[model samples]
Target: MSYLIKPAGYQALLDLQQTEMGIKRIKDFFQQNLSSELKLRRVTAPLFVLKGMGINDDLNGVERAVNFPIKDMQDASAEIVHSLAKWKRLTLADYYINEGYGIYTDMNAIRADEELGNLHSLYVDQWDWERVMTPKDRNVEFLKKVVNRIYSAMVRTEYLVYEAFPVITPVLPEEITFLHAEELLQRYPGLTAKEREDSAAKEFGAVFIIGIGCKLSSGEPHDGRAPDYDDWITETENGYRGLNGDLIVWNPVLQRSVELSSMGIRVDREALLEQLRISGQESRQELYFHKRLLAGELPQSIGGGIGQSRLCMFYLRKGHIGEIQAAIWPQEMRLEAEKNGMPLI
Candidate 1:
């Protein structure tokens, strides 16, 4: 079921040794740029949390978390985090972080249910970050401002990477274009959601599509978003809606749209209850995290994860994500990549 492709004339921009060094350079440079740009401090994060704590991210509200029972704590279960989407917000409150400041962590996760593909594997790594914000900051304008800052950091990282390894030419645009999901749907009414993204990314070079979770005019969402996080359904000013979106860039080597990050303004109490109701997840209201959030115990915040391997693949000009990160791939995929001179890590 993997969507395999052998990009014509594709080749790794860096060899095995150079790739290893490049990864460190990229990770270090990007993290520094990101932290400085967003005023974020590095923090340590947990690999797993106690089951039933409502701290684990229920991505798409269906994918299961890798869970097991703690031997000494009878009947106590632990689940590997899918993402720090919820945990980061809780941490901001726990650390007593004030508004205008935040924290970022090197988040590692395992998504056992992830479909194997050129862009996906069971292993996941990202830079997860969250910041405290006032109620007045949770709007479309602020969301756009944050998105631009992240994009700037990405651009700066690209420049540094190319400077260190001149062999890899920069492919990112000077500025990323912004588009609404509804606008994209209207432009390509005949195309499916993925196809629409591909079309937009190709046209714009880089694009951020807003209003991801809510039902569009076509009676379906541009993409599925968990209700407990990203405020994708809230109505904001200036005819803008949904304070969350994904940052996508057209990968020239793969000839496809690659999503590097999914971020947005976190939901407030009202938006949380409303989004949960819309997604028919009202039962989550009884969960500990949800209950605490509804009771105004957590901080108002904005956060998201920037995929480590995805960025590496894109910047390294590799056709498949496996070229950047070590992961299991189907035998056929391995043969295909080998045939094209693209080796799996």
Candidate 2:
């Protein structure tokens, strides 16, 4: 069954027509501002990659990847990308990209297993980015610095959005709150990780939730991430605090944060092996690309995917994600949104 959210009188926030224009202006402003700030050169990305290349992100190792047979390559299959996290790292290594700079690409994909909802569809699109870094750059301070740059970019984008559409009340904060996942669990032992993110972000206006993938003090992943990318202990998960002090967690299940991105420090050789052992995905070591990586064939890098639609949704503040993009939705959800005066694009 599909899920619904209480609009909290958010129904009349923006008229439908202005919302559309705001989405366009906001996207343009951020792309220009972020590209300038990050020194990112935009590149074209693929929707599907050859299977067995170790390029596709296996989210939590269980989500199904949409795949199709390759007509030209005998016995080969191509799968729609889940994210560019792994692929970007490989690209950096293969290209011998220099340290302290990177690239961003428009990545589009299909997530067939995504449960239908106000926030999710089989369709996915994002800005996938990665950069080469020195060994010394792979530390908490560096990561936090990068996150701050990103947050600053977001804030700048928000300002431009407001300038274009004054109706937006500047829901995003100027600074981001930072914390470890374990600390959050300690702060709210009874609440789930989602609840913890919500509470913390609500308090800080913007927050970076750290320590993903590995088991929290509660003995479960604060949330599942592919064990290959982010280092759980050192890495922090990030999200924006909402005006309501609610965690802007994308309720993909309920059409919330819309998870515009999943980014992290790419695993180094040793961390890669350790993560493999911990997740019992050692069998993957035999995969073609995995074997090369295990043999230290890949380069050290960091990367992630930022959801295009999710960013649009955040700036627009529309109740349902459908307002900004075209995608399939369950029948009941369509009717429910209409009943609440929400329009699907």
Candidate 3:
């Protein structure tokens, strides 16, 4: 069953009409700020890729993709993209993007297997971005630097949103704290991974928990990340591991941690092989995308997806993701949201 959290004395900060305007404003403002800060150029991305091409994100290696046969082409099937993690890397090479430069796209996807809840939705919309980088740049310091840039963009966008919609106060901290997953595990040994995230976010206001996807000292990953994209198994010069992580914040509306992005440095050939072996997904090395990576055909890059609607929901202090995006919801959830005066778009 999906979980729900209803904050006490919660109400819509902006009415439906105003919320519509606020969504557009936030999207515009954030994208501009992000592109400027990251040296990214906006680009067009595909909604679906041909099946058997191994282009779709196999999120957790379990969630199924929405696929169908193309009538005009015999034996050809197209699958709706879950995210552009792998595709973006190929695009960098195709566009001949140089190091320090990249591209960002407004990506819309369908997660058919997603469970319904205040934070979870079947429809996913995010700013998917990728940037080329030199081998020397693939380190924890570079990852943290890029993360701080993104965080700065978010803080700037928050101020802009608050100025336009005064009722929606800003709750984000001026600077976000960084914590490693293993440290969090040590700090809260009795808590589950999600519970640890909640404790850290509540205490720090905003945090970036590093070292995801790889098994911690406890013999389980702090969170699940796809093996192909993030180089989670590699350790840095300081003995810290994982080149990727999630940006989590304390959401007052839900009284829980809200993850706004999942990103990391794209895996190189060695890291990819190691991660595949560790995740027991070595068979994927035969897939078209995986083969190209193994052959060193794709560019070295860092990339991630920032949820557009989730950011709006958090910045606007909405109770649910559906309030900022048009998406299907369960009847019971709709009724519950209505009873709580929470608007779902």
CA RMSD of each candidate after superposition: 1.1, 4.5, 1.0
Q: TM-score of every model?
A: 0.97, 0.90, 0.98
- Ranking the candidates on TM-score from highest down gives 3, 1, 2
**Is candidate 2 or 3 superior in lDDT?**
3
For 1-345, candidate 1 gives per-residue lDDT tens digits of: 676788998777788998888889899999999999899999999999998878899889899999999999996899999999999998998899999999999999999999887799889999999988899997877888999999999998898889988988888899999888999999988999999999999998999999989888888899999999999878877564698999999999888899999999999999999998988889999998899899999999999999999998888888888888898888988988899978887
Better of 2 and 3 by TM-score: 3
Residue-by-residue lDDT tens digits, candidate 3, 126-201: 9999999999998988998999999999999999988998877888899999888998999988999999999999
Model 3 alpha-carbon drift over 4 Å, by segment: none
Candidate 2 Cα outliers beyond 4 Å, as residue runs: 12-17, 233-260
Q: What does the lDDT come to for candidate 3?
A: 0.90
Error of 1 at 122 (Å): 0.5
lDDT of 2: 0.69
Q: Candidate 1 lDDT (Cα, whole model)? A: 0.90
Q: State, as a TM-score between 0 and 1, how close model 3 is to the true structure.
A: 0.98
